[model samples]
Target chain A: MKFSELKKAVAIIGIALFVVVLSGCSGGDQDQEPGEGDQAVEEGLESAAGGETCASCHTDKKKLVADLDADPPQEVEKSEESEGEG
Target chain B: MEAEDKVLVAKEFLNTVHGQQGCTSCHGGVEPAASRKEAHQGMVAEPSAQKDSKCATCHADAAGTFEMTLHKTSRGIVDLDTGVLAARINPEKADLLQKAVDNHCASCHIDQCGDCHVSRPQWSGGGLIQGHVFQETPNPILNCTACHGSRVQKEMLGQGPSDFEPKLKPSVHWVPAGMQCVECHTKEWIHGPSTEAAVRYEVKEAPRCEDCHVDDTFYDNAYHKQHAEADPGKTLLQCQVCHSQPYNNCYGCHVGKDDKGLAYFKTDKSEFDFKIGRNPLKSQDRPYDYVVVRHVPVARDTFAFYGEDLLSNFDASPTWKYATPHNIVKVAPQAESCGSCHGNEAIFLLEENVAEDEREANREVIVPKPPPKF
Candidate 1:
């Protein structure tokens, strides 16, 4: 075989390998994506209850102590708002 | 305190050994970031969604078996009941009825493990029971009664004054003894696969009187054995037929969709009565001549909102289906004497006692004549 022909053959094989690798990667990406139902349910919860993870804030003993002793109190704002509304 | 903080304060806080695994272990979807918005991203409100993945890792047997339980597949009841109705109707009309049922009846389906064990049911607007503690056995009040409130709860707890004629007593097993649902209903019965059961009666390992009573024991004395066992084939009766107290019965249940697309149901009447009718089902699991049948209050026009004359062959299935009433007493009126059931035609649902429309469906169940010199 000619030296030039062998060079062309090697280039062709390299391109073929690259295409196979690319296709395999894309297939994995599709497989890893969450299905429609699961995505919807999880997304629904994420949006619910004002985007709060109750444990994230409530479980922290320091944060809980700070929250309980909050001055002017959370109820005061609500009462004032109610008065304004009335 | 914030409203959220108040909820925390009000709850009875306790941590299980499992809690050491971190909140994100069970409740995933929180981002690792400290910001509340970022932390809550893609959060799963109920960890039950991941039961097969997370919980089943440790509780494979329970989670796998629970997947087949009646509670998990309660929607099957609605399907079976409606399928019977659909088979009689035209394809177009059946499809319409099914749509109404899917919207209304299927809404009350039971949830996954976390719904009962970790939190209150979604139907009751999900919340923590004793502040996010994992419970081994469900509290009857918080779990069972939450769903079974109207009928079983009323009967078991003797709640509704209207359901009784002269203020009936609560179940003896429940009243002084304080027996909860789980006491009699075992884990196998509750969580085990129930593929055999088309209705509750057909459940293979359903709690039977003989299960605890033990054949030939005191509770299963000569009298019980005579009726339930010795009969061979001539005369056999379910324990509930004779042992159960008068239970609540509802008539004329009507289901309809409101303008806002919510399912609403109403019953014309509810009354307490103890009546013996012939067994509607006669399977090897439940081979009985007589059984306690309760009128479920489903009329032909139960789903008239969806389509008119949907259940034309309403009499195909008996309005009165066999039931295991929650109300059971050590001594019942029927047990007083053989005549209480045999001689008394009133107690047995005779042809004359049944409504004209129901007579055809209850022909086999309705006693032809009073017991002859029993």
Candidate 2:
């Protein structure tokens, strides 16, 4: 092939590679539509106290501690055989 | 959950095998999720909840056998074959009992891998225990004692829930030796190689008093010579019979939904008791003719709140079951003198002492009479 033709082929290959890289970076899962899980996530967010996101409050130590401490887990086995025993 | 701790967890996790794979691998949230809602979509809160979860993909040895393990199955509460539930309830009402279990006892059962290794048990107020890091051996106090505190913690460490009045004292080994659960309960036993165990004591690999006190000279003690070493036809006593302190005994646990529809369990109040009874689990492994027993929280109407006559065959098993209390000492109160226990009729579970409703049920375990003071 002629020098000019070789140069044109290389340019085409470079452009194709660039387009593929660009599409790969930004186009992942974008074509899929939101489903019920996404809807539930939205609903769950609406119900979250103060509309906090996973990161917004979880990352803040004081907020996380306060939220957890407010309704913390059971620390020890409640061994009372009945409803009201010490 | 400080911001720094969160960063540290992520940072440390990234360096580990699970962390190397990244969060989206097992957790199932969107990788490049732009918003909290997007990230939350398809996210699984406990990916290891299933018997064959991604955790099983790597820890196959443990995860596979875990299904049969005491900690995972809580067999005492729910197993069909060779379980306290099975021994009590009739076959026809098994399903109903299961529903009762789900509503009331399920919290006590291990539902996921993280329940033991990464987080505090859900029954003991569920949350991250050690920041979601997979620990080979969980912190005994935070994870094991959190659920077992009523008995094991109190007996072994001599402390229990704040409500445990008349606070107990530490066992001979737990405080002075500083021995952790794994020190005796080996990893093989904890993770499990699988066995047909109806109760924790049935696990063959479980720690034994003889395992540590193997010194032959130790048996020179008259009590040990007479009891620990087998003498045919004689009433061989378990070590706990002489060593264990009065441990918590709960009776008549009734479980059902409350008027407000929340699940609740009630009992006849617990007591610190130490009673020697005929061995309910008399097998080659446990040859003792007499052993320590504790009054479990079960009655004919224990599950009546769930359904009428749910446990129709409750009389099949004794309410006073075999126990290995942790409160052991070199010289226990009962061992102060032979007379302290030999003629101590109160320490022996007798017919007159049993509740009228439980007399027939406890016939096998109820001592006809205490041994004559020799």
User: Which numbered prediction scores highest in DockQ against the true structure?
Assistant: 2
Reference contacts recovered by each candidate, as fractions?
0.03, 0.11
Candidate 1 chain B lowest-lDDT run of ten? B6-15
Q: lDDT for each of the candidates?
A: 0.67, 0.73
**CAPRI tier for the interface of model 2:** incorrect
Per-residue lDDT of model 1, residues A1-86, tens digit only: 99999999999999999999999998877885343334433342243445444454554545655655663233321111111000
For residues B211-254, write the lDDT of model 2, one tens digit per residue: 88859697788777877888785668888998887898887787
Error of 1 at B231 (Å): 2.3
Off by over 4 Å in 2: A1-86, B1-14, B160-167, B193-195
Model 1 Cα lDDT, one tens digit per residue, B1-374 = 23343334111232344554555676665644445556556767676755475778788888888887778766444564533343334454767767766765665756688777866676655556766667888888778877877678877886665635546668878888798788778777888887776555556777777777754465356567668673555578888877787777788777765555555677788777778888888777778888888877777787787888777666677877788888887767777777676677767777877788778877777877757547
Per-prediction DockQ comes to: 0.02, 0.06
Clashes of 2: 6
Per-prediction TM-score: 0.75, 0.77
